[model samples]
Target chain A: MTTQANTDGIVYQLRDLSVNLRRRGQDRQILQSLNFEVRKRECLSIVGPSGTGKTTLLRALAGLIPVEGEITFQGQKLEGPAGDAVLVFQDYGNALLRWRTVKKNVALGIEGRIPREESRLRVDEALEIVGLQKYQDSYPWELSGGMQQRVQIARALAMKPQVLLFDEPFGSLDAMTREGLQDELLRVRSLHEATCVFITHDIDEAVYLGDRLMLLSGSPASLTYELDIPLTGTRSQISTKESAEFLRLRHQVYEQMRKAHGAAPTTE
Target chain B: MTTRTPISLTKSGIRGNRRHHDGKGVAPMIGLLPIAILLVIWQFLGNPHSVFFPLPSHWWTAIQGVEQQGNLWSSILATSLTFIESIIVAALIGTSLGIALGSIRWGGKALDPLLDFLRNLPAAALVPAAAIVLGTNTKMALVIVVLSSIWPILLNTRAEIQNLSPVLSSSIINLRLSGWHRLSVMIGSALPGILLGIRVAAPLALIVTLLAEFITNLSGVGALILSAQQNFNSAEVYALLVVAGLLALAVNSLVSAIEASVLRRHGPST
Candidate 1:
């Protein structure tokens, strides 16, 4: 099921994006001057220490956070919540509305602007793409954690977004379930060829999935440095994680993060 | 006796329930014995010639009188209509106002005090003042009922819509939903709260209508009860009171069932 990206290659362009949250008349710049670009069908993994504004950065790019920078989508300025980017929240259970069945939640991804029949068709097709065709009518609570996350992914896929932003979507699941989901995510994403940006603290996840990995510093968080990961073939938690190159990249990312946090590394 | 030790006298009520559930069918009937005993006491206390309550035999006759003469049907019908009219009107107005108030960020701060002042005014206290304007009829009854029933509906609905998970609000904005469309989602989404409010308002409708009837000289079950009391016809008074309680129960059950259905339809599936 091939879909079209809105642009020739570039999907979302954020130039000098900075988010400042004001509380009690005090200015707290959460993220400052975060410049990034997400190309079509590429995943950018943002790894940082906790409270480094990684999540806020994604929110800003998705137009959820109010920022001063010029954030453009398909050559148009994104002033507010726009359709080009879909955000997958960390809490998959809370993200999907419990009032709806799996099929209905997926259908919401298509939105209500289309004709009812056409929207239903798109919803059913999305469920199929996510490999949950048979469980369309199942409620989310009844499913296992992986299935629930799949339903969420199906909803994001239903939007047919040019760019997808995930805020630590798999951060809460068990080791086995989390690994399984990452596989499912990559599999379905490749099939759809949708642009994606995901935030995580896991170094291995950064190396495994991210085409470009950006590490952020803490408190007045800014992008310190970004690296490009060039790995081909089936990427799974178990298989590629043991590779020499993957470990080296993980080591590089960890060092950058430690430096950002201002922690002195003990030499043995 | 001084040297003797005491045993535990505490009755494990919940434990008894669990044991009872494990037993045969006969064990369940014991729960109803208390209610049966209470009814017997009520029956004796309510003897027709008794000083306090009218007799059951006397009430049977009054009920028979209404059934035989056919006018009982009209009077009951009249009262039920007025009661229902006031309640429906209140529900519609209150639900609408609540939804509107709930959406605005400062709506609660703006309207809470005013609503509190009006809702706290007491339905019965409003009788004399309302009677002066409404002039002793179904209109007066409806006015009282509306005042009593509308507040709970309005307040509950506001709480439900306003307190929705912030994420859903973001979802609504992200999707670029229109104003009317947003209300449809929010209202239906607020089913559990609105239903509970309606259930609360339903009983108030009956109570207010009964109280309102006391202010009016027109046809109603309240009017019948009043006349009976004036004439010292205790049996008739008791009989009319019975009918009123039964009517109230019926209305309460109807509203409850409707609320349950709506909740199931709109609420997240368990």
Candidate 2:
């Protein structure tokens, strides 16, 4: 797989990004003052424990929710859902149109805007990328959990977005499936040259898939720790993870996470 | 706890799973057993000399007599036609209006009180009013049936549309789907609910159709039953009543079959 990413320009720049949501007639802060920049063609993994507003942060970045501070996509203020950004939700079952065939679901984002022939080709190409070409005629539920999530990814890829926001896309999958999909995501990101912001609670996965990893934790989450992973180029699940650098980074992240959770460190 | 034999365990465990898988196919046939038994009992044991509780065979003979007079087929044809037309019209109106009201932020909520009052007015009560306005015709029957049946479809569609999953809704927006494309997706997402509404509305439509026909004395099976009663031909009355029940059964079966077949590709409704 090609590892060179054109990581010169900034794709997303957030300034003092705070998001408050109204629940049962009261405003609750879900994300506190946050600032970050995602470089082009880089995968930025945001890790946090569950219920730490990881999804809320992703939604704000996608321009799907109102926020209190400034957020810009490609230097433009995002007022609503950005046309060049697509969010692949974790709930693949709910994200897919069960009634639509795999091919049709992939074509959903581009059917009307693109020419019919072009749309068909794009759908075919996306299916090819996700290795779901065989299941094009099948409905989503007919496929396994991993395949359904691939279908969701294919749908987003067909849009040919400059940015792909994944909300723990493999969180519902089994261990083997998640590892396979992690590699698949890395390969796809390189091929598409798309900027990605992946949210997950899995430290190993974040380290494996991300170019830069940031820890988002707290009652109302904000970026608490940031690191640039030293390992690059094509990474296999076994060798890269077994490397000393990978272990050191993983240990550091684990300690930071324990600290974020307010747990006392164990005595050596 | 009692110790179970290995054979019994297999029967309850492995075989039980298979039975559960096959339950849907077998249950409907099993359900008909009681009705079949009831009919057989009535045929053999019921008093043939009774006025109101005529034997099942007498019902068949009375229906044959009506058929010999040539009114039976025409009445069946008219009632079936009216019911089918009413259902189609109601479905169209209900689906479109439901989508409209459901799409708007304030539309469904703002009109809830008015819709509640309107839908609560019974189809039977409106039959006379409709007949007077449309003059005891098929058109009037159509109106009454549509009015009564449209609610289920409308409300179900609205509720389904309004309750779209956040992820799915966000996907739609992110994909930049708008105009007819967006509306079509909305419709597809709400299709299971729309079909659910149709299933609920169909029987109600059939009932309203009969009510309009009977009250207006229009030409249909309902009229046949009315004439049979007025003439005090208890056997014919019983036969026509059987015919009405058979019609209801046919309608319910047809709607359910359609729903099942259509939703097969869509997966289970829930």
Candidate 3:
């Protein structure tokens, strides 16, 4: 377990963070003593088995829920939802304002905080980053699922927050659309270098997107494994995924997931 | 990509459905064809000398009598004024109370049974009670109108507020929207449901206003219709009934137009 002593370039420092939720009149421990440091401009992907409190952990980090221990952002303790951290929800259909146009939906995060002209400019720039400039006037329902998700991303980008929290954003998307969005996300991240905390159940997606991968496991979930990706340069869907390093990292994470699930790890 | 095809197809599908919904321009005129036919048949076959039934041609003379008596415009104006005032009051009180109750769990639970009881009390039945309590006055009429018609708006607004999506509420928090902004967004999203409630309430307001006037013998279209019936002026009664129907139709169309414009501007809920 890594201690909280390492504070250099760390954007978020979680110390003995624990979260317990009441379910069916019984208090269930969701996250227990979670300790990790998310660095600046780093994409830290949290991959775990289903119902392992991965979303809860993200929600706590975003200050959407009450937790027991210390969770600090930029050296200040996060008490509640802050403007510096924006969460992109998994259900885009409900997350994106259906009544608002794509541009207005993107502007929702910054509409009143800034001047009208500045808000419009930020919205335009965010839409441009997501390659959704042409669909600015279209409603969310009018757009495809992938495009709607991009609108959600555009909304977060428009806010220009310090940290982007994604909770299985592309989980509902089909394979082709998900792959396309994954590439688009990489492109956007490269342009706008905000620290990202992406929570997903897909091991491959975690390895593909994360600068450093964290595996959460156990009933009262805690960070069980953390590994820095060996790849240093830009990642492509085809070549990077086919590379020996990417395959090795992916296998290692899968083995850890199997071990967490109480099953004998298979080499194949 | 395969996804592109389905998206375009869905767009076209929406367009196709909209076109089907709009129908041809003559569809409305076609719908009115039956009413026109009924009027024409009545005009040709009705006898003016009948004590119970009068010819459609006698309607104009009956209206002329009402105009001569100086009650035509005044009755219409009185009825309309009561209807407008009642609806406005009902909308304000209903929406405010509904939102308040919906936002607070204890408030909703505490008032649910009382509200349901009041809602079940019929507006027509309240006419006699209101006249006895407050006497036959515009105030009593207005009170009856509001009491009977406010339920739909209140109930619908409350339901919509309760059904508000958690995602949108979370977004409001994440965006750090102020209380006013949050409220406006909440109201905006709930507008469709609120307007739907208002749509039902508006006609009911008019009906209750008329019923109150009839019971109270107050100054309105309903009183005029009642007096005509007592005087055995069958033509006048029939003419006033047609006028009431036209008034109701106009009110309904106006409300529907407002609802359509709002839904268009805000976009319907997904």
The number of the candidate with the highest lDDT is: 2
> lDDT: which is higher, 1 or 3?
3
Q: Tens-digit lDDT track for model 1 on B1-270?
A: 110000011012211222332344354357557855876777777554675565566678977876686766777898899888987898899889888888888886777667778887888889888889877777888888898888777887777667766666666665555667667667766666666677778888888887777657568887777877887777778788878877886786677556555544333333
Q: Could you give candidate 2's per-residue lDDT for residues A1-268 as a string of tens digits? A: 1223342388888999999999999999999999999988889999988889999999888888999888878877779877788999999988899889999999999997889999999999999999999999999989999999999999999989889999999998999999999999988987888889999988999999989999998878888999999796689899999999999998999899888888733311
Assess the local accuracy of residue A73 in candidate 1 as a C-alpha lDDT between 0 and 100: 78
Global local distance difference test of model 3: 0.84
Model 2 stretches astray by more than 4 angstroms: A1-8, A264-268, B1-30, B107-109, B268-270
Ranked by TM-score, top first: 2, 3, 1
Worst 10 residues of 3 chain A by lDDT: A1-10
Query: Model 2 over residues B1-270: C-alpha lDDT tens digits?
Result: 111122233224322333333355466567778977998999899997999888888888999999999999999999999999999999999999988888899875688877788888898899878777888889999999999999888887777777778888888888888999888888878776777678778989888887887888899998998889898899899889878888887887777667666666676433
Docking class of 1: acceptable
Q: Of the candidates numbered 1 and 2, which has the greater DockQ value?
A: 2
Give one digit per residue, the lDDT tens place, for model 3 in A1-268: 1224555578899999999998999999999998898999999999888799999998888888899999988777889885588999989887877778899899987888899999999999999999999999998888899999999999999989889999999999998898888888898899999999999888888899999999999999988899998786888889988999999999999888888787743322
Q: Tell me the lDDT of model 1 at B97.
A: 87
Off by over 4 Å in 3: A1-8, A262-268, B1-50, B53-60, B128-135, B266-269
Task: Judge candidate 3 at residue B241 and give its lDDT.
Answer: 92
lDDT of all predictions, in order shown?
Answer: 0.74, 0.85, 0.84
Better of 1 and 2 by TM-score: 2
